[model samples]
Target: MGIEREIKLALPPEQADAADRFFSGIAGTPGRDVPLVNIYFDTPALALAGQKVALRLRKTPDGWLQTLKAAGSVQGGLHSRHEWETSVPGEALDFVALEHACDDAAALAALRAAASELGERFRTAFVRRLWQFEFDGARIEAAIDRGEVTAQVSGQTRREAISEIELELLRGEEPALHALTVRLSAAVAGLTPEDINKAQRGYRLCAQ
Candidate 1:
């Protein structure tokens, strides 16, 4: 039960450009441009009603990943959290090196560019803070992450009571994040290949 965690403040949807400046000073991971998709899942209106809570599934060439991000209350103030994430190649869970720097600049640009290509469906529709989690299991490898997601609207809205559980694995000093990623790619689904990164891939830059 090894899980890694990171948290960041979120810029409003219209102010997403802040992420570009925020990451510019930090990220340095390497990769070619690719296609990406962000999908948000909603609970029954009856469950959350006038509140904000959603499950976001992001699909890219690497594969598909899921996040539990919602506008709600918790131990902290009113902050959103990413409960779980799934990787296809399974090797992505341990790849935290790029994540920290990606939280910086170059990474922000990639996400912004990807989001732009995604168009209105995913544009500055909504914004929430970001929280990331990684988990590895002896029997299986898995993870849970939290990021911004969109609100929901339905033709015939129904309501239900619901709460979700998320999991994540962090590759610490010994195993290394990259090694953990490989392990997680096993039990999860809807993840792609490119999401994987080396343990220190972004270290040099992120440390700055």
Candidate 2:
């Protein structure tokens, strides 16, 4: 199990260019752009969601990966969550591995039983740009994502725009993460803390 600490910031569409320029200096080398498709899974009754956890199958250039994220608190755009992920052959979930890695015995048992019933609930497809930086004695990964969260329900589809900046702490003190976000916020205008994640947004869209 891995603990993920990051901050998500909502950005205005028009501010994209300015945000890019602001980080150009701090980010020494930019990584190649990657397009990603993520499918969220859950039982029809949303058992996993009720447990405050989420399951996702992500398709990237490297390949497909299955990830299980445990419930974590989100406040003022700062999120701290526990996650477990492994490479998979396809979009199919490997329940055995996930259940084995889960620390919560009850949650794991429940997931094991519900695994067979899991189905795709929503999806997010986006183009993401990555940059890594060492700031204040901390390693951080800055991701700029632009895409849409699309959900199909009752033979209809709903879509929502996703334009945000995510600063993930690769290895560093938590305070450094906060400091970087504060600095970026000052440089870019109209940036606000985002409490809702992509999965949450997609689920809401599906519900609507």
Question: Using lDDT as the measure, which candidate wins?
Answer: 2
Instruction: Estimate the Cα RMSD of every predicted model relative to the unseen true structure.
Output: 18.7, 1.2
- For 58-84, candidate 2 gives per-residue lDDT tens digits of 999999998888888899999999888
In candidate 1, what are the lDDT values of residues 155-186, reduced to their tens digit?
33222211111122233332333344443333
lDDT of 2 at 63: 94
Mark the 10 consecutive residues where model 2 has the least summed lDDT: 23-32
What TM-score fits each model? 0.29, 0.96
| Model 1 misplacement above 4 A | 1-4, 10-22, 27-36, 46-54, 67-82, 88-208
lDDT of 2: 0.87
| Best of the candidates, TM-score | 2
